[model samples]
Target: MSSEAKPLSGLRVLIPRGGPWGDLVSRALRERGAHTVTAPLVDFAHTSEEDQLVDALKRLEAGEFDWMTATSSTVADVLTHHNAVIPQETNVAVVGEATAVAFRDAGYHITRTPERENSTHALLEEWSEIDTGDVLKVLTLRSDVAIPVLTEGLIDRGHDVTQVLAFRTVGVPASVHIREDIESGRINALLVASAKIAEEVAAQFPQLPENTIVACVGVNTLEVAAALGLPDDADDPAHADYELKRALIESVESVIDQSDMLD
Candidate 1:
């Protein structure tokens, strides 16, 4: 498409994340003609149980599991940090686009990612199709604060599932300029990917401009945003860059209409 025909031209969007994924998203947005401001509101830290995490990585390298699940890109970073190796025989399932990209970027292969939902439950639902019926050994790495839903679901599916706490999610304070931008409607849209991100957005930008579009990455995140009083204008479970770009386009159009009215 021509520059003028691009969906997100002249739009400024806020991404509440940093690092590889944030950089990737920013690049994608720029390609579609949007200006991106990345102010990470969350950062991952090592889990307190260092010994347990180390032991799990050693076991993972030793090929003790037939399948391993990585729910987020942050978990993939933790794996890279610990030098965790997955044997060739073990299949790795990544939950979302971010995790798949992160794994591939980290020089690991992904066996599967839920084609539709980008969630753990979707992975479990596709288990029979992805694996043989016989009981299999699996290792799941996730944030410390993550619910044990995936582990419990794997157990229910007759797999030997070992759950390991990989890291902890902590809030990162937004800079004063980021805070001021939200209040002044300088950002046309905010992309919220997780409950924690929603909480951070809520905590950091207590009052969002009415014209600011809030888009959630999935239905669950949408619900969480709603509960936190930050109801979203759009949602995409897969958190695709294209979807986020489309949402921003709609917000940009709305902004244009409001400006026309004011004129």
Candidate 2:
């Protein structure tokens, strides 16, 4: 389609995370004729309990666990950074497609992922259907600040579960120019992917233009954004980059329709 025919033509979108994922999202936005500003609002740091993490990975490589759970892409990065190995007999489960892709990119195979939603609750529900045998040993790797929903749910099912903090999520403030653009309404939409990013956005950019859209990646993030005082402009249940793109496009179109009606 021509640039003028694209739904997002002349739009400026703010992507709150940088690196490979941000690059991918930026490319998608540009394909739709939107100018993307890539600013990382959150970053990962090595866990404080480095020894504990190392020991857990050692056990993981020794084939002590029957199943391994990866909740985020950062967990996959941790595994790759540590050179952790998963035996052929071990099955790997992920919370969402993004995490599965991360694991696959790290040379790991995924055994299962939630069919409908990309949250821990959804993963747990899916696990109940395929769960079999007695007391399967499970290893769950997650961020330090993440709730232990998946780990607790597995334990309740009578599985031997080991919970390891894979990394720490830290907030990064956006550049002054980026902040100014957001405050001045130069930004057309803000993409929020996680609760932490939402929190940082709320903290850093307290006031947004009345017409600017706050697009969330999933239901969980939308809830967090609502709590943070961000408008419920758009959200995608799939929690994938492509889904976010669709939400942004539809939202912008809706806004344009409303403005046209007013004019």
Candidate 3:
């Protein structure tokens, strides 16, 4: 479609994560005629609990756990970085498509993922289907700042769960120009993929322009954004990049429609 015909033709969108995923998102936004800003707002660090993490991975490689749970791509990265192994007998459950892709990319097999929503609660809801046996051994890998929802939920279900901190999430401040654009309303929308990113955005941009749209990638992220006092003008139902782009387009169009109505 022509630039004028594109839904986001004159808009600028901020993608908060950088790397191959951010590049893909930027390309997708450009395809929709959006001026994309790819700024990474969060970075991963080695967990402070190194000994504990190493011991857990050693046990995981020894095939002591029946199932392993991966909640984020950072978890998969930690596993790969540590050269962890997953015996064929050990099944891997992921929280969402993104995590599944990350595990697969890291040469790990994914046994299960939430059929519907991409949240810990959704994973817990499908837990029974993943394992019918009672009192199974499960290993859950997560970031330092992550809530122990999966671990607690599995424990409540009568399973022996071992939760390990795989990495730490640290904030990366946006460049001065990017911050200025956001504060001045040059950026039309901000794509938030996780709660951590939402936290960073909230900390960095305390007051956003009324016209700026804060779009979250999933239900959990939307909840976090709401709690942090960030406006939830749009949300992607799924964690996929394409779905996020579609959500932005639809939201921008909705705003245009409302403005036209007022005029």
Candidate 4:
């Protein structure tokens, strides 16, 4: 189709996360003719137990840890907030594309990133391939609510793992105006990346209009949304921010085209 006749032309898409991620997704969608609305449903807060996190960072910078892994971009934010330094000897492994970008932006070199699935399980699956021999010390920075899958998995493989809480996810309520827009079917699609955002969406937009397309980024978030009764209208297997936006635009365009044919 012509540029002026882009698939997502005149569509309204709701982006769940804010900051650079939100900006990137919004720009990509807008370029595809979708009017993007950023309603941040979740925000990261400092870990409640500050001392433990601080001590972990100290050890990390002291070359005590042989490897450090960051599962989310938010972990990069936590590292930047504390001015935490990773010794040159410590190799870094990141999971998601956004997380990789965040670490690079924060001046850290990544040693490894999962090829296909950007989940903890995926990271562990490729752990043997990335590090053939057992490493002495490994530090994992993750959200408070995140499971200790990576740590547990690594320990099983005979590696010393020190997992630290880098941040906590707090929900942000959507404004009444945004609520009205979703209830009124003004939003053509809602995109979510985490289970926390899915919970917020489920709570805020209880009665989503039938025409509102719900798109999820990662497998965990998609499963969460499905469990919460939010049908997955569109999904991206890559779980990258850009890929998700592209999928949303393409899916909405298909729906619109089918509707036009019916009319």
lDDT of the candidates, in the order given? 0.72, 0.73, 0.73, 0.72
Report the C-alpha lDDT of model 3 over 1-263, residue by residue, as the tens digit: 79888766776889786644565557767777788888899888999989999999999999999999876666777888999999999988877444666788889998877765555677778767435766889898887777677788788878888887878889999999999989898887887767888899999999998767777665556688899999754334543344444657454332111111010
lDDT of 4 by residue, 125-159 (tens): 87664357756688887877675667777888878
In angstroms, the error of model 3 at 16 is 1.0
What TM-score, over all chains together, does every model reach? 0.80, 0.79, 0.77, 0.80
Whole-structure CA lDDT of model 4:
0.72
Candidate order, TM-score descending: 4, 1, 2, 3
Clashing residue pairs in candidate 2 (N, C-alpha, C atoms within 3 angstroms): none
Per-candidate clashes, comma-separated: 0, 0, 0, 0
**Candidate 4: where are CA atoms >4 Å away?**
1-5, 115-122, 125-131, 231-246, 249-263
Candidate 1 matches the true fold with a TM-score of 0.80
In the order shown, the candidates' Cα RMSDs to the true structure are 8.2, 7.9, 7.9, 7.9
TM-score of 3: 0.77
Candidate 2 vs candidate 4, lDDT winner: 2
Off by over 4 Å in 3: 1-9, 19-35, 117-119, 128-133, 217-228, 231-246, 249-263
